[model samples]
Target: MTFAVNPNASLFLLPDPVTCFRSASYNQIQTFHLTADASAVILDWVTSGRRSLGEEWVFSRYYSVNEVFVDGKRIAKDAMLLDDSQIDAKPLPERALAERLRPYSCYATLFLVGPQVQAVIAELVRRYQAISVMKMKSPDKVIWSLSPITGNDYTSVIVRVAGEETEDVKGWLGEGLEPLRQCIGKDVYRQAFR
Candidate 1:
């Protein structure tokens, strides 16, 4: 079955904002039982505007419990993040790395804090699609095995840049950030660390 947004919970990006839910209905959600690979597609859908409206949503599995809770109910906790052995030690194939780095000379995982992040994410998706020749929507699309980071009060995004230098990539991300700050307010904090 195709994934559908839960009507019960609020819709927002993961890495939950470090604040209270904006509305009462933002609790009690439902979502698909997405595997790690399929999650990239789902996240793309969110960023791509396929699932637009809905405040409260639900997930088939609670991926993490860092700071996500609704009505005193804690979401499922991920034991893997807590356990070192849970990670696969194998290195990525050189070809795969080359392919991911191709076109985009650098990659970084971004930690963004501000309001209206979903809106900001939508813009990022559009920009990435415009600039990157790759068919996929975002860096996570190329690296589908990585799990989505879900937290309350904060959210993480992955970005790819045409330049390898850290300063250049930072500038690229910063140039577009001004528009987002307008929606989310100037208190936005962004850190793009690989």
Candidate 2:
């Protein structure tokens, strides 16, 4: 899918989580083009197949790519590929893709771009900077990170989150992005989170 935002205009894209099925492959690509003054919020996320059916990470493959261009110049590009067939552990016991991502069943990525999101970016940065990571016996229920796109005016931010359950990630994201309500309006923002 592709999107184009006009100058000074804002757009919000909140899509449902993608679910991969066993023996199936899922691929998605999205591109956004925006004028210097345009603003946009994009979200891409996926679940680890049907958990109740015991099909977690049983899919053959999963691929996703998201790119953003401002004034015809590429600002950010995020891509991920997970394939069971690509696992090759010749010297050790057999390994599966699920092993690499154990303890997490949901993953999400969010992008905020343009002047309108400066406040959101700043808030996220402040919160992220205050975190102190420490070694633990078990992984956290949810983990997230925030980073700014380098080489660009500090108007863009990328957030990645992984959680043991889908609802956990959703709640975290909803709170983290609460400032967006001012730009996208309370009604629209509530729709996305609710």
Best by lDDT: 2
Relative to the true structure, candidate 2 reaches a TM of 0.93
Candidate 1 lDDT for residue 174? 59
Model 2 weakest lDDT span, ten residues long = 146-155
Top of the candidates by TM-score:
2
Using all chains and alpha carbons, the TM-scores for the candidates as numbered come to 0.30, 0.93
How do the residues 17-124 of candidate 2 rate in per-residue lDDT, one tens digit apiece? 888988789999999999999998899998899989999999999999999999999999999888888546668777787987888999999999998888888888
Error of 2 at 160 (Å): 0.9
Off by over 4 Å in 1: 1-107, 112-115, 132-163, 183-194
Off by over 4 Å in 2: none
Q: lDDT at 81 for candidate 1?
A: 14
